[model samples]
Target: MKHSNGAQLFLRNDPAKTAPLSTKKPLTIGKASTNLLCMPQTDGVADHHAVVRWSVGHGWLICDWGSQEGTFLEGQRIRNCRPISDGDEIQLGKVGPVLVFRLAPASSQPTPEPAVKSSAGGNLEFAGQLIPMNQIKFVQLLSRPRYPASFSWWALLSLGALVVLPWPPAFWTLELVVLAGWIVLGSRKEHVLLVTLLDGMAYRHSFANKVTALGHRNGIRKAIGQPSSA
Candidate 1:
């Protein structure tokens, strides 16, 4: 695919073999072609089954190349060409091999600065909260902890309190409080990082950091087509 941004195709069933679809040429997928980028070993796959192409304006596209069984995307059979987005599943031939697609940010586009905007004296709007940037002790991106919504420390403390408390009513109340907290603050999307800001008052805010510091560093390298620093 001729994508300005890099694209990746991963085998959904067998995630070991991942193909980088960052080249300008269209990636050919088939059963027995030396020129093919992905050659699945499943039955019903033709020699030239399908082609995944990309362009700057149109984005990524998957086109069926007159295969016998046909190409299916997310269970529906594609007529000829279909536009695909990140996390879209592409099945070459009917029930042959499922592949997941992911498109990175285009290297041509400029990286935006952190979404901090000045409002008052040394204060800025960060994650919908107006707080003094200077008061921020640190900022970091945290992946969703295994527990539902509460922070790890909060969970541990609450659990310990429940264990030590002798009153049965108090234990149940604490459990209900934890459950309510999870219900109120739990995120719906998986794999999204939470941007946390710790301030002088020991208060923390968990907000979405679309462009994290680490992301900024890596994005700068990707935008310039430079090798990432170790």
Candidate 2:
């Protein structure tokens, strides 16, 4: 069955569990009675944690409700509000539940081509890479960098090591030098295209990255046909 141009939220740990969002009303996700979507009783989730709403102007929007643990998109903590697209991962709290967002099939969508050709053995071409359709467990299109370009674990550890230095000027100078080094070594930001294999390993591709979530969804549909049975 085909759906509309909405979104699907899938539980990362449990792929069978899902929340389909294609409505006008905001979907409330939390661990309490008032929420429309009740998450499992777990640490880090507040009584009323976060909300996913749809607007004609913005498409989909995710907002945090000032929880103690906080909500995260990809890996960055959400501050006020952020626009969400297909294939984006939303992590609740620091070690809380993880949800993957996907674009729903539109009602007017065309019939998908066969996922595999009997003679060719199901090969798919994506982002200049040849993928075996049967081996792909999932596909995600990322518009932003998952990790902060300027932040690194080595930089943080170096800063911690400098705590033993004298406070007046030695510590300050080292801090500035470390910060400059981090900036100089920062990596370039590019669009990320991820393909997860059945063995749980993932392949990544980076490029010009101008495609929208919906555009990626359509492309995947054409490449792999309809969604596979879970």
Estimated TM-score per prediction?
Answer: 0.42, 0.44
lDDT of each: 0.62, 0.69
Model 2: CA > 4 A from native: 1-6, 106-230
RMSD of 1: 16.1
Best by TM-score: 2
Backbone N/Cα/C clashes per model: 0, 0
lDDT, model 2, position 145: 45
Worst 10 residues of 2 by lDDT: 108-117
Q: Give the per-residue lDDT digits (tens) of candidate 1, residues 1-230.
A: 22224477888876667776743577888877554564656776788888887643356788898888899988889987888888899887766878888777676423333344233234433332445654544443445644563556467867797779879898878877876777556654223422233533433334345345456434333333335453
How well does candidate 2 score on lDDT at residue 150? 60
Residue 218, candidate 1: how far off, in angstroms?
40
